[model samples]
Target: MRLLASSLLLLCLSAYSEGTVISKEPGESIHLTCSSEECPTYSNEYHYLYLYYTIDEEAEVVFSNIKSERFSPRGKYESRTKLDIHNRTITLSNLTASDTGIYKCVYKKSSTEKITCSVYAVFITEKTPCSTVSPAVEPSPVLMYIIFVCIISVLAMWILMLLILPKVQQRFIKRRAMHAHQSSADNVYEIMRREEGAQVAAPIGLV
Candidate 1:
């Protein structure tokens, strides 16, 4: 049993030895490189670079060079996937847990057995030691300036609104009261005119 397990482990390690291994956090972007001149894979004279993702030996092809003669690539990967045949590279952004798996890069001259080059790709999301991780990037001065300007604008607007809004509201209320009083006076004057007209016409009416 121990011998079998040891052999299996070694086999698994050997299975992933062909190409580069990358590790990244979720939602991060990654760029993968494939060389046509690279050893063993030789990978030369290919028209397109196809990326396959899987857990088993066989993988689900996720992205391909659309402009390739033999293949136009699949539709679902168009949003966050990109491939370059000239540079022999692939880039994927905004990765998720679903993306964590074995990825393979294949260079295809055509769909035929005449030429197909493949290399294994391994990725891990498990927490790596700090030494392996890239250093945290510092905020740029332009970004800091923009943030500072935004904060200042917000605080200035807030203070101006706080100081001026109440005075404007008070003035509005006074104008409304004045208009109401004018309306009431107009109504009273209309009634008085009516009463005076009635008294002058009848002379028998007491107002």
Candidate 2:
């Protein structure tokens, strides 16, 4: 019994020591393996695998074979995460600006046995046209001066119209009143001549 217990302890230690990592770029897949050289049954007991990513002082379990638990992701790593249990691989697809970081794999043999390994990954995202260069564009001095001159011209025209329009209207009204008074005086003189002709014709008829 004492020899059997010692053999079991050695088997467990050997199983924990066996781990391999495959490096991959962003938007690619990475495989992690935990197996034992001595015991075939111990190597096959891969119950679950947990994949974690860390960027900008934040760490999160992005993928896991055990699906019922809640996993929290920080920074811009809340999405674009996946895991495959049959092949022991984690795939981060459609990577973006925030996928550049260190990624780790944790293998869980059972409720108690666990092992971990980590690798560094980098993602080079394309920059926009505005962010790539510096020195912001400024409007030309000639354009600014032209705009100022246009505004001043428009204001001066408005002020001139406001000052001249009322005086012109008053002058036109006075001319119309003078013309009407002259027409009335001419009609009165014609009526007086007709009355004088009627009186002279009546005296000739009596004679």
In candidate 1, position 23 carries an lDDT of: 56
The reply for model 2, stretches above 4 Å from the true place, is: 1-46, 56-58, 66-79, 110-112, 127-207
lDDT of 2 at 198: 97
Best by lDDT: 1
Q: List pairs with backbone clashes in candidate 2.
A: none
In the range 82-176, model 1's lDDT, one tens digit per residue, is 65555656677877644644566665567773333445544434233656755554443533443354455566867888988889999999999
Top TM-score model = 1
Compared to the true structure, candidate 1 yields what TM-score? 0.42
Looking at model 2, residue 50 earns an lDDT score of 56
lDDT of each: 0.56, 0.49
Model 2 lDDT-worst window of ten: 33-42
